[model samples]
Target: MRCPYCGSQDSQVKDSRPAEDGGAIRRRRVCPDCGGRFTTFERVQLRELTVTKKSGKRVPFDRDKLARSVETALRKRPVEAERVERLINGIVRRLEQSGEAEIPSEEIGSMVMEALKGLDDVAYVRFASVYRDFREARDFETVIGELSRPARSAPDDGA
Candidate 1:
């Protein structure tokens, strides 16, 4: 690694250790020329994800924006912010696991709808109405129909 202080290419690692979470490595390096010491961190580089819109426009993935949409949908609801974050994380993870760098915007919306469905009915409908671009009253009914489905199974281990 090049020395950040002296810009010297000749450097050696003084020490290396794993970070607390074990997701990254921290390295202390010293420049041979200037004896300058510095620290560096190394972490996995996530692959860039792209979203293809209906208008044929491709955009970089934005997780904060997606989380904000979920927050809006869950407004005044009993769901917690951490739950929303977890929902966003789960969606991103699922997309990445698909091994596709580019995903359609509609697919993302559908994923959001499915996630919100498991979260809360009202929030799911709110997000669906906006994401599905509900044109009229019948659009509302369609989502409401999906929301009002009967619960088929017992709750998971979590309360």
Candidate 2:
């Protein structure tokens, strides 16, 4: 590796360790010419994944965009960033594991809604209303009702 201080091409690794997240390798290197020490992070490069829209248009799959949409729906709420990040990571992992190079936009939207639904009801409704394209007030009310209703334990539960 080239040294940033003296632009020396010769460098030796003094120490190697795994990053805190354990996703990459952190290396301590020293330039032979200038004796400058630097740190470098190395990680595996994965193939780029693309998402195919319903209209046959293909675009690169972006996890950050998905997370941003979720964050927007959850704005001003008590939820923290780590929880939202974990939720987004879960959804992204599912998509990546599906082995499909291209995923539909609708599927991604639904996945985000499902993830939010489990995290926060208000956020879920907000995301769902926009995602499902609620055209009337009744649609929103119906979703709210569904969310408000308590879960029935038995098939014979009658109220």
Candidate 3:
């Protein structure tokens, strides 16, 4: 591993363990040159994902960008950082397991909206406003209405 302090290419791993969520491996490393210590989290990549943007441009999927968007929406909210990390991990996992190397940007946005909807109402709306491109106040009201409405129950089995 490279050391961030001295930009040295030689770093020794002192310890290694599973991350808190168990989705990644945490490694404690020390730079021999600067004696600086830092921790790094490593995750297994099932496959490289390419995102098909709305502009017909294909780009490599960025996990950090997605995390930043969610965090921005959840800013000043009651949601915990751990929960947000889990949510982002779940979304990435789903995309990776979907058996598709290229995923649509719209699909990714919808997935984020759905996950945020269940996590926090305020955060959900915050994301929806940007994702859905809410221009007027009615747009916000419409989404809020969807939240206020109750879920439909299953049809009677004629028991």
The candidate scoring highest on lDDT is 3
Sort the candidates on lDDT, descending order.
3, 1, 2
Tens-digit per-residue lDDT, 50-151, candidate 3: 999999999999999999999999999998888998999999999999999999999999999889989999999999999999999999999998677554
Q: Please, what is the whole-model Cα lDDT of each candidate in the order they appear?
A: 0.84, 0.82, 0.93
Model 2 TM-score relative to the real fold: 0.66
Each candidate structure's TM-score, on Cα atoms with residue i matched to residue i, is 0.66, 0.66, 0.86
How many angstroms is residue 36 displaced in model 2 relative to the true structure, after the best TM-score fit? 23
Pairs that clash in candidate 2:
none
Model 3: residues with Cα > 4 Å off, grouped in runs: 151-159
lDDT score, candidate 3, position 68: 95
Model 1 residue 101 distance off true place after TM-score fit, in angstroms: 0.7
lDDT of model number 1: 0.84
For model 1, the stretches where C-alpha displacement exceeds 4 angstroms are 1-45, 150-159
Question: Per-candidate RMSD vs. true structure?
Answer: 9.1, 6.6, 4.0
Give a tens-digit lDDT track for model 1, residues 1-159: 888898988899989998625646999999999988999877553678899999999999887788888899999999987677678777877887788999999999989988889999999989988988889999999878766665445654656
